[model samples]
Target: MSPWVADIEAAVDSVLQAYHRPGLPGVSVGVLAQGEVRLRKGYGLADIAGRRPNAPDVPMRIASLSKQFLVTVVLMLEAEGALSIDDDVHRYLPDLPDYGTPVTLRDLMSNQSGVRDFLELRLLCGGNFSDPATADESYALVKSASRLNFRPGTAFAYSNSGFMLLTLIVERLEGRSLESVLQSRLLSPLGMTQTHLARSDIPWLAQRAVPYVVENGCAARGEWSIPLDGAGGMISSIDDLLKWARYVADPASPHAAHFRRMARARPYADGTDSPYGLGFTVMPYRGLDSFGHHGQLPGVFAEIAWFPQIDAALVLLANTTEINPFHLGRRLADALFPAALAPRFPPEVVPPGHYYDPGENRVLRVLRQPDGENYLDSAMTRAPVEWHQAGRFRPYWPMLHLQLAAQDDALVGHDGPRAVAYRRLPTGYAGAPERFTGTFYLPGLESLWRISLHDGQLTLALTGRFGTRHFHLTPLTDEVLIATPAQAPDGHYRPTLRITGAHGQRRLMITTDRTSRLVAGEMLPSTDR
Candidate 1:
């Protein structure tokens, strides 16, 4: 092995040492250089009770990393003249509500379809991931959305609902199940015999790693009963994925044209390019050009990053929620190419406080850790910011290089092509929670929310598939409030409710990271109240 490769293998061991201990769920890591596998190994146990150690061949749920293969299937169909990326989505799935604009397959591929994410919609309806759902049911859920987040192709918003629609399109064209189409067309040709889609209706392989939720040094099995589709429902081992990585990286491969097309960034309506391409996030890391995707389920976290400049790739799959594959992939990349990476500097100190963005009607909490690290908190996500120069920093979420610069009275930046500014709010700013106390109904979603104030704390309660869930509401501005689940299954959904209109005609506009433009009208006082 070369000196650098040896150094990287050692670094991998050091980075994964924490998860390599006893009674813990662990990760399966693979590294590739020049289209060759340099390191393929596993750390920790796959099943704690069985005492089975994770191995390179142990299949695990890759979650959304399944998108690349799905996208490839779509491209293959296009090549066969079965479909076209430019074709309107309604051409294949006419059941989708007309949003008064053409939403093409390309828009879905590049996450520009403006479709509301069905998972977020399900959460809004008080449904949990553990709730049982069928493909038809999920399809109906997606079709029930009466509106889009924005006009198609105008902006970029990550939506799994788009992929779900694509899956339907592929299935309708091929007249076969997505699983069968993927296996016969892609996996079989690549000789990936061990890799296959895991459907909710079928039993999974016994050799698959057991997913766990590790807390306080204890491991518990994670629950996921919802049906798996093209959105995120595939199982594979590190060995099989390395085969895929090598094939995609090869310049002379048959699918080279498709890979290139998939890597090209899609431009917005105004001509600014998006960081995301067809099912992949195309962006620069440190100083190297890279394209990859990250996947997360209840108990799974997976990352695949390919650096085209050096013909190197890194894959990390973990069967535990505690593991962060994205950050680990970066660490492995640093070890693999130390000289090529840009130098890091301390983050510019923007005073830790609540900053409100008037354009988006949201609040961002800038927090400083005791160890001097800085983080940006938006809705339910918290991402670490790495500062490269004075007053400028980048967040590590969404796989987008979202940069923000500290200004005199505001932090201004661009999220892809859209400009955003977050002005710092006064310290200890509080809103009158009672003003938002009322019952509201959203006609589009057929969901109702009751906002109540008890003992100086406000909460929003809604009932659906999983029964009633009460979310604690914290005021961001006098008119904006953030709602968080009061119990377990936390962090899955944090939506912001903004009050609009006058007293008698007041309404609540709900927005999440994925779905927006949902408004709920306040119901009149009934006899029950």
Candidate 2:
């Protein structure tokens, strides 16, 4: 064993030890260097009441981490010339309504299809993830409510519905169940015997690491029964994940050629580049290239990050819903390799303007701080950013780098790939105040919004997870307005809100990038007396 192994082990232990509270669910972690397993361990409990101790070989749901397999199957079809990534998805699955432009296979795979996420859409529609549906049922739901957030390939919005379409495509092309294809093509060849894609019609495994959700104190078993075979459903162990991570970095693997092809960093139509590829996110963190994916559902959270440049991989599979594998994966990397961990974003020089990205029908504004700094504003979050050369920018704090649209002068780019595209707005725009004073509700989200006109300005309040958040609305145009969260006094959360109405009926739509891409939602008048 290397002498540095002790330091790495201790660092990882410090982080996991904190999660090892008595009666709470725990996690399984694996560390591999140069495609070799250096450390594999379990912390806390896999089943608290049954008293079954967690281990590296215990199987747990991998959630969206399963997307790579679906991506692989689709790429195989592409390789065989049966289908091309650029082909119109209507060629394979015509059930999906055409929202003007045809969404291509590449668009679906890369999250630029403008398709709304199936899971969140369900939630927005007064449904939860607990109820499982058949693949056909899931497809019909998205197609029935068929609408694209934006035109295909214009902006980036992660959509599970897009993957679900890919799932149908793969099955139709291969003429076999996705399970059989996954087993024969990727898993079997790689010798990953433990991993399997779970389906709705037939259950695969029996006993595995039990999943949990916290109650008042003790952890209790929880379930997320959403139809997830293509988008999120996956079951594997740490041992299996260790091999999968090694495979993720191995260019010699069966799908290495396809892997490299899919991993190519995507530059959006707006000239902004992001870390997301076909199914993987290829990012530069502290001077190293990290290839990884994170998956989450109720009662499960899984994440695996492979630094191909360093030949290092970090994985975390937790049965508990509260454990955020993405955050933990980053921390694990920091602990194992402490070199070059310092952050160097949110630069000192700030750009100030309202960038209008009509491609996605959104606005991104950066305002000057009294402290001489600049911050990005939105309804969701308010974070500081710094200007970089050649139309690029780096967010100092959140580890985001952006490539702006092709511009003559301004340093412009998305903080990361698939971010909003911004064109510097021209000078001189008018104001409209009385048009928006009303109560609106987004039925799908089960959330409410109130806009009021006071003293020729608009004040908006939204009931969110963090209670009601308030923002002062400034009109960019008669139809569009900018609302920066008052909580972020420094100006990081700038959400562009657009209102459309006719005959006393109105709709308010939000097009900001965050955990989920929100679009084309109704804003109904409040009946509250």
Best by TM-score: 1
- lDDT at residue 241 of model 1 (Cα atoms): 93
Query: Which ten residues in a row are the worst by lDDT in model 2?
Result: 391-400
lDDT (C-alpha, whole model) for all candidates: 0.82, 0.69
Runs off by more than 4 Å, candidate 1: 1-5, 388-390, 399-401, 429-431, 464-466, 490-492, 527-529
Candidate 2 stretches greater than 4 Å from native: 1-6, 200-206, 215-218, 340-505, 510-529
TM-score of each: 0.95, 0.73
lDDT tens per residue, model 2, 2-41: 3134566788898898767776788988988887898888
